[model samples]
Target chain A: MSDVFGVGVIGAGPVTQAIHLPTLARMPDRFRVTAIMDVDEPVAESVAGRVGARHSTSADDLIGDPGVDVVAVCSPHRFHAEQVEAACYAGKAAVLCEKPLALTVADAERVAQVSRETGVPVIVGAMHTFDPGWLGAKANWGDLQETVRVVNSSIVLPWNARYEDWATQILRRPPPGEPVADDALSRSVAVRDAVLGLAVHNLPHVRHFLPDVESVDWAESVDPYGYLVTIRGGGIIARLLGNMHGYWKPSWTLDAWAADQSLHVEFPPSYVQAGSSVATLTSDTQTRRFGGVEANGYEAEWLRVWELAAGIVPQGEDLQATVDDLIYAVRIADAAADLVRGEHARDRVR
Target chain B: MTEFADRPHLVTLPSGPAHRDIAAALASLPRSFRPGAGEDAIVYVTGDDDWPASVEHALSVARRAIVVIQPGYAQPSTVLRLAERAATDSVPVMIDYAFASNPAVVLAAAAWSAAVEPTGILDVTSRHAGDGTGPMAVLLDQLAALHSLVGPVRTIRQLHIDGDAHSAVVAIPVGGGVITATLLGARTELGSRGSRVRWLGPTEALELEVPHAGTAGPGYSRHVTTEGEQLAPTIYENAHRATLARLSRHLEAGAGRCDDLTTLAGHLELVPREHPSRSASQRTSDQRAN
Candidate 1:
């Protein structure tokens, strides 16, 4: 691998234009955009032209490009698994797949197996997991993982379009879908999507404390896009609440408490590069804060990716851990959906 | 609505740890009220222990008015019986819940109703120290605050209590739609003790932060609309002091009616029976056994 690894991105959506591209622009020495591909040819061409990289309408073309050393799979959810597998097989130094690695556990298992077989490391784009603030708290919080009794994750934000539009000028945008029905099946699916799409970013953090999830006590879908779920695991109870509405003030916070210590972290919203999350750890006698880093999670994750590809540092997260994270998210989503379905069925019977 | 011909004297009935705080609030009252003994005085009762019996005693003794500081829980039957007695006696009685009595709550409620449609979810989180009270008390304090801000809780969809932490999802009727409220109470010794209530609507959002009772820390309220975000002016008085001031105003205006008992009863009725089959103590025992 050369000093600067040439990169290929599989999707040119708002995330690519707003988050990854901007982050890559910050690290011109470590990485370079060599190829950009999207099913929308114009978006691929327009985004690639900005960085003076090659443009293509096929993922294979981008992955096979001789100049591309690192591949970023940023396509829709369903294509993430296959594209990642292709990138690994193509002998890329590393692959950065946007979250959910795959929707189904089977697909995740397959991706894990392929990564292990090919020896090409893959990192999921669950940005908060890589946030320096979260890392700092994790390093400093003593015995919280074992002793934590309660965990709460609350995410309240405006629509993504509000932030995406402010972050970058896009060449193409997907149209909004039809309204979701009020029935149980529709609600279950909506909540599942919410967990995978929005809450997935923080599930890794939640799982860090509640490692062995035992059961979901309650789950409900909040209208206009959100979910309220309570799950017990690792001798701790965790509540996850998320709502994406038209509210102007956006608050994304995670709080966990043990008998004698507590951790609270507030993450910046996605799309706009607003530095890193701010975390505070409080003990009975003292409180410590970590944050204000110039680099946000997106930048931090890319830096890690560059380091992993260049063999500067050992793989921080192995294939099995990645698969485990995916499985946990999928299980939580499925459990929540099943609870909603069951409640609705019981209600109908009554 | 006739003003009292003579200045209404204030008297206090002893209760629990909250008595000191209630007395501190009464000491700062304006010159319109004075300390006095006997039934003619405006009786103040801090219902921190045996609230039903204390309120019944106050109703029997007090002739002018009654003010009760809620200790976080009230039985529906007790509240109904007391409310009927207060109504028949034609004495105005106000139940001052710690969080709901904060002046900021009223401001936030008004701004929330005026700025947006009453059709979204209200998120509330209450954090308290483990030593102060049990989970049920903390949850009831939160629910009382919610009742003051919005209306009565219609139904409790789910309630889960694990040790000192309590969480519930309940619905509150608003306009033509129902606003679902997620009430979460966390008891930890490390963080500050307070309650935060938030309502997010399409074009507006409202947030209120009320500190635990007895502390004079200012409660904060932020209202955001399409134009911009506006924060209400901070009030330096604690909830107890504010409740006292409110009662003073009501007495001066000769208001003889209060629905605090009725609302308290309604909320008490809505709280689900404690996990149907297993008592909380039994569940704790089961966990220990496991």
Candidate 2:
């Protein structure tokens, strides 16, 4: 095995900076970020500088590099499927892509298909599957878990505004008559993607705790105000709670109950203090407490990729499971999209 | 002193967890009532400017009122304005150290004899509470000692003291109900005040004095069984270091601003025309000049 795999990073956004690059730097001997590819040259260059890698403005340049063995895709939602397939075609040994695997199942399936033909191991970036809290939960939960009942996950976004500070400024100052994609469908898609992008990171986590998810009969209700999801799988009904309306809820909260016991995990919002998460497990006799540990969601996921590639754990292959979970999450997303579209069509009809 | 029943409605302004804890404790009062969203008679203002008008708007009705001053942080101007407003309507005021970041407010508290409902504010500094000058940690430990002995049945209305030169007391109503243990820590400066220590005085922990039948109603007691000691040594140190670093940053910013670091208001009057030298001895003289 190569002592250090030269990894090509496909996105220079917050995820790459906050999660992927930091985790790679921590374990230098196992993986080295050799290059970065992003549509924005400056962003790619800046991220490359931070991680000490060369920059590529094009995806082809990044995947084609002889020094790059593994490709980590952190691109936008629309671009992930093509990028992943391209990296696989470029003969990269491992292609690790960020989750909500794609905007649609067709895109996710295309990437999945390319991986099947090229024989390159592809992992989605859903690191929550290996969360320390979840690990502790699994340990505390006994095997052959009796009937799984309810899984409640809530991701509250306090500052889920129309745009971030930078994006808001750009939108305000754009040149005249430039077609800005500002429509109900685009807005609804953004909302769906927020759920797909942020919420799906933890789907594998909820699934891990309740391992018998046979089918997901998901219902979604979304308006300009908020989004709420009800998903029933593995005899366990899960509620994903988030209100685009309110500003002060926790970023993520999950409660999973089996026949004899239940697990509760609360994750702090992004860029807050590390290990500031809390987890509680309650059975008939006792309740256990787990918190006061740093959280590195993005870094944790990247580390899993490195560890799996290095043979530290048996395949360290939770990403495939993540893709499967994303498919289920997309069903929720699709339901929400249909509701939103139907509402828009009704408004138009009237 | 116990003559006043729960007449002084405990109003806690929404601050961080500590303020929220105070609100929770006050809300849990058996005879306590939360004024409707638009029916706040008494309003409390703390550090954040998030919710005063909303509170004032909420208290659409009711005549009696109480306002808690955040000790050092509340401006003297703001305090006087509040005092005047309270006086205009004959509203009583119970000043709490909810605003310790501003010295002007602390000084302002000394002014209003009539407008201030309580003759003097309750100060729960470790120095006053007989705990040594270690920090809020030691004071919290002392309080925790009393907290450990209570069963699920006991609850105490506590005036919690920390090493920081601040004090806040809330009515804690615990009646065999599960108590939620919350953790709190922050960076702090090492002050020169002597500890309230003398030899250990009483075998039994102090009891919270409640004034009325309503205040002392069932399901609430002034005794809380100590939960286990939470080790926060590192957290305390981090907070202390951060505070020191912030202070140092402020000092390095410029002389006029750096003078704010001097806790005593008189010292603020003496900030010299020239920047004080880096020498600790020179800084002492600068302090003395005030």
Best by TM-score: 1
Best-matching candidate per DockQ: 1
Error of 2 at B103 (Å): 37
Which digits, one per residue and each the tens of the lDDT, describe model 2 over residues B82-148?
Answer: 4445445544443232112112222222221112121111111122111212223232322222232
Q: How large is the interface RMSD of each prediction? A: 2.0, 24.3
Query: B1-290, model 1: which lDDT tens digit per residue?
Result: 43443554666544566768877776776454566678787777655435667678878888778887654455676688888888888787887766777777866666555553555578888777644346666667778787777777788788877788877888787777677788887776754778899887655778889887768888888887667788888778888778767777777776777777877777767766676312543454355559
**What does the lDDT read for residue A74 in candidate 1?**
91
Model 1 chain A: worst 10 consecutive residues (lDDT sum) = A170-179
For model 2, state the Cα shift of residue B30 in Å. 15
lDDT of each: 0.80, 0.46
**Candidate 1 clashing pairs?**
none
lDDT of 2 by residue, A129-199 (tens): 65667666667667514544546565544443322223222233322222214355864565476567566
